[model samples]
Target: MITLAGKKALVLGIANNRSIAWAIAQAFHSAGAELAVNYLPDEKGRFEAKVRELTAPLAPAIFAPCDVRDDAQIAHLFETIASKWGRLDILVHCLAFGNKEDLQGPFTQIRRDGYSLAMEVSAFSLIALANRAVSLMPDGGSILTLTYIGSTRVMEGYGVMGPAKAALEANTRYLAAELGKQNVRVNAVSAGPIRTLAASGLGNIHEAIHKTEAASAIKRAVTQEEVANTALFLASDLASAITGQTIYVDCGFSIMGG
Candidate 1:
């Protein structure tokens, strides 16, 4: 049993109960880790309220608003963590976004702003959060981010998000190397297609899921809970030696040659 007793974990990007971040938070809470969760702020406050409600059962020590695009918000989130828990043991980043327009058309037709937005939110935000998180992890910690097979393979309809994920995986490796001396680990989980609010933005998610089920070794798509379990193992001391790699939870879809 990999336990996170006495650990403090901060999970960002939980939009709702269906989010992979939500699943990871539940798993962490179940394993005895204290939690801090973040939600992206919107003009209407709907996101904040929904996230609060969904995380209510977990009883997170801090549930705050964070827009990764804003440096001050990110700083504030980590500062609050430092003031409250005085340290962090685990950081789970499950955020990614791309314009629906960018995801539908030809990859070459992706708008510059859309491409930049996708890269900033999906890829660079990991570096930004890890930068702030490291200060709160003096004793070392685990930083886990979500990626996808689209990062390496060109999945149709995935569009600019593919390049964004690619950059995220590269960031994972570099951060892992730089943080290793401190015993802090960084890794990415490449999860299979699932029906989540985020995935709903994709034009062909249903088609992708069906294709994945038909071709994958498991003959099915993975659930959020399954991906969350893999995250638990990586976050716990059980995976102390694992770092700088993208662990695929894609039901063996990535291994298929055709």
Candidate 2:
């Protein structure tokens, strides 16, 4: 069995049970890794309650508050992880945000603030989290982030999020290069469309979902569990030789030829 026993993972951006982050958390738990969840400041107590309800049987880890947008909060998050676990073995950067308006309209109409906010939340946060995680990953570790096909291909209504994911994909490669020297592996999982809370913000996302499934070789949508399985592999020692790669778990959707 590919076990993550004794490993500790920090998972961010679990908006709800349907979130890919939650799926990753469950996968890591099943593989024997202890899980620590991060909740946004606004939803601290609320999400804590939810985590408690979900994790009570296994009692995986305490849900800590972390708003990735705030440097102070991010600093405190890493500090707490260091103090409690003394080290971190895996980091899942599932955080991303964007102005709904910018996601729906023409890319050229995106406002400066909306564009900047999208990049900061959707792309740069991964870099910020990785920088802090390296200090705690003394024995080497894995860092994974989520991306989409929109990064390289234009998808309707994906708008600025596409460019943001492009930057995120680039960040994964650049950071992997720098972090590999320390024995840490960094990668991105470009997933097929799922009805996550974040994806709901996109205008007419249902159409995008249909288009993706219709194009995929499987002729069906990819589930969060499918993506989580890929994340689990990348986070395990079995994938020690893999880094700076974007693994797509989209039922071969990204490989479709016109």
Q: What is the lDDT of every predicted structure here?
A: 0.94, 0.90
Report the lDDT tens digits of candidate 1 across residue range 65-161.
9999999999999999989999999999998999998987888889899999999999999999999999889999999999999888889888889
Quote the RMSD, in angstroms, for model 2. 1.5
Best by lDDT: 1
lDDT of 2 by residue, 1-258 (tens): 678999999988877788999899989999999888877765347766775676566565656788878999999989988888999999999988888889888788999999999999999999999999999999999999999999999888888899999999999999999999999999999999999888898867788789878989999999999999999999999999999999999999989996
Superposed Cα deviation of residue 66, candidate 1 (Å): 0.3
Where does candidate 1 clash, by residue pair?
none
Among all windows of ten consecutive residues in candidate 2, which has the lowest summed lDDT?
54-63
Candidate 1, TM-score vs. the true structure?
0.99
Q: What TM-score against the true fold does each predicted structure earn?
A: 0.99, 0.96
Whole-model lDDT for model 2 versus the true structure? Answer: 0.90
Best by TM-score: 1
